[model samples]
Target: MSLNKAVMLLKIIFILTAATSIQGKVYHPSYIDEASTFASSSEYDYIVIGGGTAGCPLAATLSQKYKVLLLERGGSPYGNPNVTQMQNFHISLMDTSPDSPSQPFVSTDGVINARARVLGGGTCINAGFYSRASPSFVKSVGWQEDFVNDSYRWIERQIVHCPNLAPWQAAVRDGLLMAGVSPFNGYTYDHVYGTKVGGTIFDKSGYRSTAADLLSAANHTNLRVLLRATVLKIRFDQSGSRPKAVGVLFKDENGNHHLASLNVGEGKSQVIISAGAIGSPQLLMLSGIGPKSHLKAKKVPVVLHNKFVGKGMADNPLNSIFIPTKKQVKQSLIQIVGITKYGSYIEASSGFSQSSKSISYHHGIMSAEAGQLATIPPKERSFEAISSYIEKKVKKKIPIEAFRGGFILSKIAGPNSKGHLKLIDTNIDNNPEVTFNYFSDPFDLHRCVKGIETIAKMVHTSHLLNLTNDDDYSMKMLLNISVDANINFIPKHFNDTSSLEQFCKDTVITIWHYHGGCQVGKVVDSDYKLLGVDGAMVVDGSTFLKSPGTNPQATVLMMGRYVGVKILRERLGSEAGV
Candidate 1:
């Protein structure tokens, strides 16, 4: 062959390789990009606001059919090694501060909770606990069978949810069980969710698993993830009565605003809000799609008067009782459990094997009187009621003095009290007023009291008692002594345990599980489409009508996948060629 011809062929091959690699490249925009460049561009079929949880998956799925653009207000998640490692994610929370680009939203009320402002969204900074929705929750929301079935299949295929227990997690679970705490079945069936006597733990696969998994799986061509890009507003076509979301207005790190209009047919464009409970509602309110009164008060014109935009906020209140362990367990036990349950994945990728050791146990009070549980008003349900209910249930389940070892009781679904996320000021950049109004409901207060009492009972149980040494047991004995004793034992360590109600109020902390605000039916339909808004939807936990009974990450992913399929099917038709 001629030398000239060979050179030409080589050049063609080189160009092809480069193009393919560029298509596969993951875009990680920083805070330094010139905003003017993004503002001038006018290309994209679908613009997904908030590149966290739901947005990431939506981008990957829609990209299969059309050009998709994902706008994240935060920076790239790749630089943080702690985010990649599972065990490190928890500790990484300590590093999250007001200054971090990965967390753009901050609680005005000082509370330490991590929200990932990175490309993967909250998934980049979560505990990596993969729990499915409770059956009762699914049925309550009226999710069609087809939708529910598709969600399960999509999750199993996209997100690996089998137990990834590390050795440390296993040891913890075993120790807890050996000390008489039973594991609840983790799976759910119908209105019944399964709980086991043993706690479930995930392996050492890194903490952040959202974009790393879905984007890797879909392998789409037209999808682009733009980090450090915050959407400032949604532009609507002014000519129409029911305004159409024609484009989105976004700002890069330089504070420059860019507008990208919808390019339909090339791909029908729509905005999917997966910016999490706080961000999604904030964005909606910023764009004039919130409570009319609040919007007007802030001098922002109202486009949609959705009173429920940020009203039904909910989160799990965790009250931990630290039980002193007899043995100094190495943290490596976390890795061991992961290898045991997900050995194949660990061996194949070396990702799961090195995963962290995070153990979570689930135990709750089941009302024996059935409908009697619903007697309290939903909004009026306080932590006290929740605590009382727990006590009643525990008294029925086991003897109050059955537990004697050192252990902690973590309670989810503490209260049913509602909270609101209102605009703090006219400035869209400022965070909203987030009041959990935690423990405001009577049921919530009762449940907390009961939860504490139940924990105390477990501490006195035989199994727990056997694990405690004589000295520790004697100390407990002294606290229980009567006033008739010659020397009154005012045990300093036991002062915190004097009363169940007091113990609950002092020890209970937010479990970092927030949801329900902008809930389904009230704000949006079951499919997550806004009740009155066209060309927009809320796809985060904000749309959850009622808080599910476990970690919500898996359920959130399922909702995203479910919504993605519905949108795709509607747009492309069931038989349309991909």
Candidate 2:
């Protein structure tokens, strides 16, 4: 190894060792408290709306000099096994309980997808893949390169790890190279073209470290985090020249209401909304800051009518093929990826353990999407309604065992097929109606086809077939003719161009990489502040025009720290009269 590479390896080892040393201990920060403990009203220099991936790090960084308050709608992830363990990954998404960490929503396009509801957001339930956004992406967004690099390092030091590739992942990596993906870039965190082993949030022992761990760096005396505190509205002071967001109305877990306001200080206090893509736009509309016609129709008093508030929504279209091996494959999540020039990404996961009960529940949830109960007008769901929905939708019991198979997934890169999000109900807890309009652009459809072809070539490579315990003939037969409950085989002999295009349309699913809605240069200014409002900003995936990297978790985490540092610099400059 070169001098720089050796030093880098040593640094990673030190950090990982320090992280492993604390695996067995529970260390809840002193700033954390239940929402019920809050008074009727409180004030802070910075009020962060969502305590998810971006919110935690933003709040932690701001607390270094100013008082900060972070409000989360769900319970903590500290004690949740489904969120903390890698093996139970699918269970969290399949869970349909009232307080489940993953909240399922069906789009108008007839796709069933889930979003994060817990304090740590998607990081708590994701496949834990981690990679930084490309330098070109940072430059496009006009962020300082040095600051972005520092922020990425800040996040990596806490939760990121170089994964020890399992046998299946190793074979896939070799196959990617053999199939002309080109230039093997060994292990890396950089988002470069070609096959490479990327960082994972799951450690060697399969324990997931989330963005919430960033809160350990917070100044407890300056920060206060309230769990189960759902913000209902952003209260504006119309007396000002521009309607200024001065406070927010929120409800506690016990159904009691409370208000959190910005403090009257010289530091330019503000309310920052770090809610996910769906939640941020929904909250903004609920606060009367959407299109005039839509708000009036919903009986919501209009505050600021920006036609683009909920426009420009987009979700990367994902297509996958299931490979069911005859022998047991070591279970793993996404630890390796193949970045292609054809505008698609290839990744694989093996041996995901899914319980029979959860599989049944998953089936019922998707089935319910086609029924009237899924589109019920009520914002609050009752237990009886849920029970009725399940009973009616689940006609037969599914006999799914712990799955021993793996999947080869291809995700479209920066999909040009844009969508929109709109309110279905007024309640903050309710899911909004969204339509991704997958493959609406011909370019996106072509990319999907190219991606599928790449995966087909990789599957046929000798590297993959040779490493498998099953004989080559059987594996080829399985590839040629096998259909699972979830995925259908898109055979290597699928030569017709029209057939491949239709297959792309018929089997498209979400990789949970959806972003946009309150996009930059539209609803928000370059600084992420809402265009027509003051004292408020939206700083999450909702503001992105394109998804960053192979996985967005790392960039999203870096964004929180990046924005915090900028705000601090501005405040310091103001204090010095620069």
Candidate 3:
């Protein structure tokens, strides 16, 4: 070979090697757990305290210009089929293992819901429904519209899928409109009132695309992702009137403590808390940056006394009704939603019945519903999970039908109701005292009652209800059916409106969309910086000021994309890397 030809081949080899090395920067939690590998004293330009729905994308975007460390308290979602498959959506929630993606926790109000613990956070286990923030919601949160639009496009290209609705989902779309949700808006990424089909995170093949996919956009040379690295606390500098978050102390898989600090630099060096609704405020208060008196009660030394950290915690409480049909309805999650003239919102899914496994963990009103569904008085109604095997072996041969067929849920999108988190123990591993205080305000209960009535009316008008038999049918009869729970006041029918109020109390479930701990207006400034802390910021669902009036995953992703670009824009001229 000629010397010049050999030299050219060597140059190509060197270029390829360099590119591969750059993309291999992310590490497992144990890599940093070792004292020698990652000394207790380490630093970075940005330390993101959660590898969740928001944290992953935000870190990816930020890494384009500067160094970023993303620490997650759970395992990676890459190989976990329970998390990666849309079919295992319910199974993931029912998983009882310590490292299960969905960590079940009971709120003080007796609400039974799980917290997301996998690297992609809630997106790993949530129903995979996707819808953009309402224009009003975007405006209320004080976002720049053009940036919001671009950000949505950027993130959507990575994870959002325009789904082809199943037979059941299509029926739901028509039912929503028939129920007075009004003028069908057709397929849209835009969120608004009235019946409309929206985008989803689940693709046509039933494979889920999560925020973890967005990590592909990261400048791998500058980004480091560590899993099972639980952040214990955010350490702060208290020399000034307000505290400044300088570093985070985290525990690795081995329970060894490590600290990540801001590198010696300018204003951009900071710690960010995107630990989610329950976790963000919990960590802030653990770091001594919450309501002064509440911190004092928890025996945590007050660092900043920002009263709003854990205040105004709100969840879109789901009022659920399980409809039994003679024909099997295809299994699915939220695909189409109904927006009422009132503030309430309605959505439906098929094959999404609360599991017998989860029923074992029931508390409060959930226990009542679980009890009613349990202790089967002979197996009358039944539904088999549909799969290719079932289709080929059973369904194609015998025509087996599904019994536990329909799922209907109503939510008060803009709830007047609110709750707060209380510290149960100073130990960071212990779950905080979560209280929904649902129905504490009667007006809130009134809205829910009205929503229930509207759903009942909608069910009657829905073509979906045609599957019911003449013997046991009608929305009133469905409401009257209950698990053999010995609760008093068995409703004979819905004729007496009085029974409806009691019914609402009996079957409420969380759609699991928890928002507001470090809220936008009250806890963080318009820029998403902590109100009383410097060198820190929060970018997650907790930052939402109002409910999206629909499933909130899309809005949360939009926030992640929006905040990431905003940080870059803020340091446009000043930062060295940018």
Which number leads on TM-score? 2
lDDT of each: 0.53, 0.78, 0.69
The TM-score obtained by model 2 is 0.87
User: How many clashing pairs per prediction, in order?
Assistant: 74, 0, 2
- Candidate 3 residue spans exceeding 4 A from truth: 1-42, 352-403, 469-495, 573-578
lDDT for 509 (candidate 3): 57
Among all windows of 10 consecutive residues in model 2, the one with the lowest summed lDDT is 364-373
- lDDT string for model 2 (1-578, tens) is 23234334433543453466447644456778889888755689999999988998999899988889999998788866778887667656656566888888867766667889888888998999999999999999989999899999999999999898998898789878988887889899998999999999999999999878888888889999998999999999888668888889999999999989899666388999999999999999999999999999998899998999888888988877655555556778899899998989999887644334434233222322222223232222333443444345322321222134566778898999999999988988889999888899999999988887887777768766664555464345444343322223454345666777777776676788899989999988888988888899999999999999998999999999999989988878655211
| lDDT by residue for model 3 (426-484), tens | 88777888777666667667777777776666567547666565434644344434322
TM-score of 3: 0.83
The TM-score of candidate 1 is 0.72
Better of 2 and 3 by lDDT: 2
Better of 2 and 3 by TM-score: 2
The C-alpha stretches of model 2 lying farther than 4 A from their native spots are: 1-28, 354-402, 467-487, 491-493, 573-578
TM-scores for all predictions: 0.72, 0.87, 0.83
- Root-mean-square deviation per candidate: 14.4, 9.1, 11.7
lDDT of 1 at 307: 88
